[model samples]
Target: MFWHRATDYILSSNYMAHRFCYLLQPGLIWTNVVMDSLIAASYLLIFLALFWMSSRLRQVAEINRYVWIFVAFGTFIVACGMTHVMEVITLWWPIYRFSTVVKTICAAASVPTAILFVRIAPALTRNMERFIFMLSTTQQEKDRALTSLIASEKLAVAGRISASIAHEISNPLESVGNVLHLLRTGAGLSPEMQRLVDSAQGEIIRAGDIARSTLSLYRESAAPVEVSLVPLLQSIIDLQAPALVRNNIQIQTRMRATVAIRAYPGELRQVLINLIQNAAAAIGEDGKIFVRVQPRRGGYSITVADNGPGVQPADRTRLFSLFFTTKGEQGTGLGLWLAHSLIEKLGGRIKFRSRTAGEAAIRGTLFNIWLPLGTPPYVPLAPFSSVQAGRRQMQKTASVASR
Candidate 1:
């Protein structure tokens, strides 16, 4: 009896479901099959796209709070795809119960997706705004850095060209100086003409000194040798005479003793020139510069003092820093730095004293240099006698020219 009733109930349920099904004509069945297949394929493509988006979002999930919303969207797309897949399956099999389950899952996924979109919309908008601001700031910084790079490249090129020109000028300057020396010694002239020739010679010598200094900028490191301090300082002063005369600056020298020290001559000359030039630039017209050399314990102390608008205390600290200049655009700011480095290499020290214009009691700058009379690497074959002979020869030439 029980088996017969179960069979009857099954038959009734099947008949009712069949009544709901449309007539399965050949064309209609094929059309439904094709449409369902296409829908499934489209849903698969949508699922793939959503999956890719979700993976990208996952990469930044740690930093982004909106990751969960995107994840929910992907879940909703997957559920939708499953419903289409169920539709394809139901077209062949009567899996109506499974199709209903897939529909329920899709509905569940869509609810959270909608709620999350509503909750996270403002946050996403704020993130977009911040991203735009950061991009703009980054672009501005890149532009500024590019500009600075271009400027630096231009300055470097200019420096190279200047160095090359200075080097080329050095050779010609030496040749001209030699020619002037010959004219001064070989020519016979009246007193006035002789005086003019001497003046020209002096000017030529000064030009030669400038050329040498410029060349030294490009030259390699030179070996230290014994050099007389008195003559070296005098030569620098003579080289600076034209500038001094133009500014009406008077130079006073007091030599307590003549001393020789082991040093790099070019570097020493460069330092002296830089100091004196700085003094000349500092002083006004009719200013006085006092240079004093005195024997110390086992070395010599040379002081270069100038009456000028002195350096402020704040500026003294950075005086030896490269490219840090008090004279804007006009100064290279390398003189004091180079001098300090060269002085240190020669086992010497440099110091300074100054009082600005605000200090009415005293207002000037003084640079003190101390160099030890270290053991000479090698004795010069000819000593002070060679210098004396050169002076005698010059006097004789002048007298002969006068006669």
Candidate 2:
């Protein structure tokens, strides 16, 4: 079979050469020339057979029809030109009157093929890019689903502690109310008793704060409030100050925009706290963290970055992937992913950039969160008594003032 194929190739090339010579003249009937043109034309038909076979292959395999069309037409026209060249070279030694005409016709046919390749190339590139993007988005979503499952498991464990924390809050809260009532009404209370009452009230207040902290970790949702950014950030910093100091992470905050956003202040606070803690954790000791806020197009942006060991090159791509942690056993990998989900729900975007190369632990990562302006505030369930409602608002005012 191999020998037969080789013999056929030899005769085909010889026939094409003879056809190249014939195209040079109109009526020159050299028998050898006529025979060779017939032979070359026959071989060119073989290329057509291959083209048809390719079409059948495409049909069976469900390959693209356009690709088959490009191959079919491209092969046919090039074969025609090859046969014309053969007649010019083998059938006639010198140039004939029609030689230049054949050249011009061949050149004209070649333009469409050249233009097709250029046009098709960009379309192919766009399709490949879209396919790759779709694949990446699907993988990310699957990772998020897995991460959420793991977090749900963690919350289940944490819920046991939450019940205890709530009880602890109720006991001291009742005692606080009793002592304050005694001081205000003073039913048989003495002057020195007032001092003791004040001291005891202070301690009761401290206990209530501890209880609040423990329970704060597990709020069902932060009640949306119209909150100013300055105080909100300060309060978070104060809460996290001890941890920041313990880790030797110095936080430098630069606020450029004084914007009042309608949002769940507590939830937003939690988001910042999570990001800040992660930033601090990234840096071991003597690391610097920068938290910057600025007004963006229609929203605000917050960037938290650390001067610590940056993310690994391979891990960078999967940074937001659920349960794919660079922190290994120490990292839950859900923090950033949850942060992303929360921010996105609030009409915001969170993005990160990590570098492992350069001086000063340029390996640190920068997380940017963009929250759009005019987002609606979160509304909590109504309080039972108007007095209690007034008191709660007053407490919020006090909290803002103290900050």
Each candidate structure's TM-score, on Cα atoms with residue i matched to residue i, is 0.48, 0.49
Candidate 1 residues lying further than 4 Å off, grouped into runs, are 1-167, 170-206, 213-221, 375-403
lDDT of 2 by residue, 1-403 (tens): 9989755554443223344545745566566556656766775777677677676666643345455545746564655656565464645343333444455666666676677767777877787699799999999899867867777667545643563566567696877769696775767778788777887777676566556654554543434556687777776776778777987779899987676877766457668888888888788778998988889998788888987788777777877766667777998777776677668767788999888765343468899998877764334332123334555798999999999
The local lDDT score (0 to 100) that residue 99 gets in candidate 2 is 48
TM-score top scorer: 2
Model 1 compared with the native: what TM-score?
Answer: 0.48
